[model samples]
Structure formats: structure tokens, C-alpha cells
Target: MKLLVTLMGVAFITLATQSQSIYSLNYTMGFGVGETSDFIGSPSFRGVTFEGRGFLDDQFSLGGYFSWSTFYEKLAGEKFTDGTATLTGTQYRYINAFPMLFQAHYYFGTDEYEPRAYLGAGAGAYKMIQRVDLGVWSIEENHWHFGLSPEVGIFYPVGMDSQLNVNLKYHYVFGVENSLNYSWFGLSVGFAWGD
Candidate 1:
């Protein structure tokens, strides 16, 4: 009876030592730049975003995001019609986008510290809009858009059960007149357990 109990205890300890995991929800703030601002001849567009991440195990994670981006462009050649300027100094467009991505992390070769790298892909939809405003006239065009994304990130443990994560991502949106494309930087906080 004593031997059986001791073996069971040892097995449990070994299993626990080998299988550790973490979970987290992160919010990111970053900016984006347009790929086609040159054609519009306006100021480059940019905006902020928010994202969330969760850990599945010690070396894997799943993430989702919702972001709002506003891009701006300044018109160089201005024209007038009906006493109203055809172009304004700048143009504004906004996108409401969502993305789902998965990542695999590696946490080896460190001095008992947890530092990892991850990569993943994403696909989602966007609510996009374009607007033009003259001194005496204004117009707006709104539609639904979709896109794909690929990203990578690094995670470093900072506390007994928490981590600091840094992410770099790129997205290219299609199905529109001018493609929606940008890169973003993200900082995230997460918590871990087990192992």
C-alpha cells in the first residue's frame, strides 16, 4: 500500500512539472499607414487599434482583435466648382476590422526564464468608409471589406505568473478600390499557471 501511494504521488509530480501553461487577454494600441496614399496625393493615413490574446498551453496561443483605423491624405492640387473647392486639405477614411489568429511559441534555451517567439495568420471583415468634403459640398461612401493578415510576437515573463509580450503584425485588405494595408506594433500583458 505504501509503495503504490508513493508511486502515484511521484507520477503526479512529474506530470505537473512537465505540463505548465498560461492564459491572457491583452489590449494593444498601435497605428497604421496606407499603401496607396501616393496616388491620392494626400497626407498618409494612420490610426489606433485594440487586440486580445489567450494562451492554450506553454507553447501555444490564440488571439482575436477589433480595431478602428482612420487614414488621412492631403490634397496638393485643389480645384473649385460651383464656388466650392473640389478637394480639401485632407481626406478621412475609417475601418472597423476583426481578426482571428493562432500562434505557436517556443520557450527553450534560456536560464530558467520564459522567453518565447510565435507566428500566426488571420482573416476577417471590415466596415470601411471614404469621405469627400468641399467647402459647400460633402459626400461619403461606405461598404463592407475583407482581408488577410500574418504576424509574429515574442513573450517574456516578468512576474511569478505574468508575462510581457511584444507583437509585430502586417495586414492587407482586399475587395476595394484601393487596398487596405498596414503594419502595427503591440504590447500585451498575460498570466500563466501550471508547470
Candidate 2:
């Protein structure tokens, strides 16, 4: 978590010094896949993303991306087993994930007045906090996992200095030790500003 923060800070500073840069704040919706779905099947509407990108040229840019997503579910009178131990009760399960990544993107068009399509990918660390509550007792664990996200998006110019941005991104976080891998698809809608 510390490393992720430090890297994001440095990336932001570097982007701020660039002559041409863009910043965006997005509302994100997430759908869990595979093991993530098995744990929390509900779609997550509580998510947000912030990004800063420095243009290297007309078609390419490098950036820092940070996002938070929360998934939760309540199961009544469920059985849970861990090793030789077993518990039966109402379970409230939750997952909070933070992903901080360095990203690179390539734009397909150079026209300033028209919409531009882009392809991008990010790679870095994911901090996951998972918890389960049974009555008054709770079990919690935190882990840092390596992750990657591949994205496709469009930028529609809405004004001289602003654009409407929409994106579809997929996140994959690798498992560590005894933890299970997590995956999700995210749809983001936002506005971008800058040169």
C-alpha cells in the first residue's frame, strides 16, 4: 500500500510537469468473475477512479491510475468451513479493493474535434481487504496482489477543454499464498479535462 501511494505521487508530479496532460475522475461499476463472483455475487456500484496522463505525442500517453471498488453480500444461515473448523450462521461478507497502476495508452485518431478511440493497459499492485461477519464475530484478512487491467475507451470532445470519456476495463489480480485470484469487469463513465 505504501509503495503504491509513493509511486502514484511520483507519477502525478511527473505528469504535472508535462506540457500536455489530462486528468479524469470516473464513476465505475464492477461485475465480479470466477472466484470473486463465488465470494460476492452482487454487482458493485460503489466504485471510483482517478487518472492522470501525460501526453508523449499526439497518439500516445503514459499515466497513473487509481481506483477503489467494494463488493458485499449477506447470506442467511450459511455454513462455512475453514480447515477442521466449521461455523453455521448468518454471514456478511465484504471485499474492498484498491488498485494503483501505471498505464500506457495509444489513441487511434489525431483529430481534435472528433471522437477518438483508444487502447490501454495498466499493471501494478492491488490491495485487497476481505472480511466476513457472523453475528458479533468477524474474520478479516488483507493482502497485496499483482494485477493487470486492459482497457478500451472513447473520448468524445464536448468542449474546448473537456471531453466525455467512457471505458470498459478488465482487472485480473493474481492470488498469493492461500488466497484466491480475483477478476472483475468495470464500466466507467467520466469527464476529462486538460490539453
Candidate 3:
């Protein structure tokens, strides 16, 4: 993660030295839906994301983002037989995830206030914690995995230095085991500012 951030910093400096540029900060709120959600038995996982990017030109930009999300669910109380012992109770399941990525974007537009669209892809790491709790016993696991995201979106200019940003991205994480794979689709809305 530190290496990815360092590489992005180098790219930003390299780009800034070459042309007139802009910088932006954005916040996004969204829901996580898919295999990871299914694994936790909940499809309403909530996420918060923060990102910063440096635009070297009208068509190219580079940045990094950090996001966190949690998926949770509760199961009704029940009794089960575990070998010779019988266990009874309600259970809770939760999964927390943190993702950090380095991204590059390509925009299709002609001017600062003109409407534009972009396509981008990012690669990095994801840290996840999965846990299950019963009245008397609990289990928890953590893992770090390689991940990738592909995104598409539109930017609606709102001012000389700002725009409303909306996007959808597909996220995939390679798991230790095939069944541990994490896949989800996310949608977000935010704003970007430049100077």
C-alpha cells in the first residue's frame, strides 16, 4: 500500500511539471452488492469513500482512493448438534473491508465546463475481516488480497472549478481460496473540484 501511494505521488509530480493542471477531492457514499454481500447474508453493505486526483490535462488524471465498508446480518436462534454436544442460540455475522487503490482516468471532453465522460481502472489491495458470533462462542478471520476495479462515469460541470461526479464500478478481489473470492458492483455520487 505504501509503495502504491509512493508511485502515484511520483506520477503526480511528473505530470505537474509538464503542463497546466487541476486537483480534486471527492467523497462518495454507496452500497455494496454481490458475492461478498451474499457471503455475509446481507446485500445492504454500506460504504464511504474518499479520493484525491491530479489532472495533467483534459484527458488524463491520476489518483488514489481509500474506502471502508461493512456487511452485517443476524440469524434467528436455533439449536444444532455438533458431534456429541448440542449448541443453542442466535448468531451474528459481520464483514468489514478496507480497500486502497491507485487509479488512472481518461476523460472525453473539450473544455472545463463541458460535459464529459470517463473510463478508469485501478489496482491495489483489500483488507477484510470476517466474523461470526454466538452467545457463547465466536470466530473471526482476516485476510489481505489483491484487487482490481473498472469504472465508467459522467461529470456534469457546475462551476469553473467544480463538477458533479457520478460513477459505477465493478470490483473484484482474488481470494486465498476460490470460494473466498470477493466481487461487487458499486454506485457513487459526489463532486470534484479543481483549480
Candidate 4:
């Protein structure tokens, strides 16, 4: 009975000593580099990211994140079939994507005032807007797919309640029709605020 009481006291003390941040909000803007398999040109993409996290413990956090990115490519004389005729000309292709995900993050090391590293993973919906322009004519389509993202990053303490954030992530969308599956490597830098 005495041993059980001692264990309960220790557990209470441990819980009381763990300090956690109430909430964290982060925003970043950057670019992604990748090419689609079916596209005829080498394309480039840019993105904006936003995240809001709540600390579950001193080292663990969970959050929801959303990002928007646009991909662009220009193709010269790409051939396509139109009924009984074949057409070829300069083509401009654009793909816009928005991903909303639920993320889990694990922060490593115990230094709150020093640079810290973290790894995270998320899965959610990816909404896509696809467009093609052939000078006088244009075609457009929209889709929604399931996707996942894996990330690694650093948090550099800049002030008492703010930090400089940098990260790299790989996003992949699955089960897309017409082989419109998308993937990219994203790099971003921004600021985070919390306790």
C-alpha cells in the first residue's frame, strides 16, 4: 500500500514538471520543383503553407495544415488528336493544388532556446486545378485526390516567443485518374509563434 502511494506521488510530480506550449501558428512561402509524368514540358511550382499546432506534450505536437501551390509548363509543338485532325502548337499548361492535412510532429532534443529539429507526417485531401492553353483555345479540369506528406525541419529560436522555421517535405497524391498523379519536393522558410 505504501509503495503504491509513492508511485502515485511520483507520477503526479512528473506530470506537473512537463512544460508545454499552449499553441503554435506558422506561415511559410516557397517553391517546389518537380515534373509530371504525362506533361510534355519541364515545369516549376511555387507554394504557400500555413499550420496551427497544439502541444500535447513537451516533445509531441498535433496540428492541421493547409497549402496551395501552382505548377506551370510551356510546351512547343506538342501533338494531340482532335477528331480526324492532328494539332500541334505552343501549349501552356498550369496545375494548381491545395492540400489540407492533419499532421503529427515529434520534436527532438530538449533545448527550447536553441535550434531544434523535428520530423512529421500528414495525410489529407489534395484539390487540383488543371488547365491548358493552345493560343486560341483552352481546356480546364478539376480533381480531388488523397495524398500524404512527410517532412523534416528546424526551429531556430529568434525571440522569447518566436522562431525561424525552415523545412523540406515530399508530397505525393495517389489514386488519380488519367495518370494525373502529382508529387513534389517543397522547401520553405518562415516564422512561428508560441510559448
Question: Pick by TM-score: which candidate is best?
Answer: 2
lDDT of 3 at 58: 68
- Candidate 4 residue 54 Cα shift, in angstroms, is 0.9
lDDT of 1 by residue, 1-195 (tens): 235334434533343344343444445443444543432333223444444444445445444454554445445445435655453344333333333222234443333256766676655555556565544456665655555667677667777666665666666656565444433333333333323
Q: Candidate 4, residues 55-143: lDDT per residue as tens digits?
A: 67767876666777777778878788989999889999887877776677899976768998999998777777888899899988777
Number of the candidate with higher TM-score, 2 or 3 = 2
Clashes per candidate (backbone, < 3 Å): 7, 0, 0, 0
In model 2, residue pairs whose N, Cα or C atoms come closer than 3 Å (at least 3 residues apart or on different chains), thus clashing, are none
Model 3: per-residue Cα lDDT over 1-195, one tens digit each: 567656755765665455445444444443455667666656534777766666766688877766776777887776779899988788887777777777888999867688889999988877877788988789887877789999998888898778888888778888875336877766667787665
Worst 10 residues of 4 by lDDT: 21-30
Clashing pairs for model 4 are none
Tens digits of lDDT, candidate 2, 1-195: 578768867987797579999898999999999999999999999999998899999899999998999999999998878999998999898989898888999999987568999999998889999898889999887899899999999999999989999999999999997777999998999999888
Span of ten consecutive residues with least summed lDDT in model 2: 1-10
Tell me the lDDT of candidate 4: 0.70
**All models, RMSD in angstroms:** 12.5, 2.0, 3.4, 10.4
Number of the top-ranking candidate, with lDDT as the measure = 2
Sort order, lDDT high to low: 2, 3, 4, 1
Where model 1 places Cα greater than 4 Å from the true spot, the runs are 1-35, 39-48, 76-113, 176-195
**2 or 3, which is superior by lDDT?**
2
Of candidates 4 and 3, the better by TM-score? 3
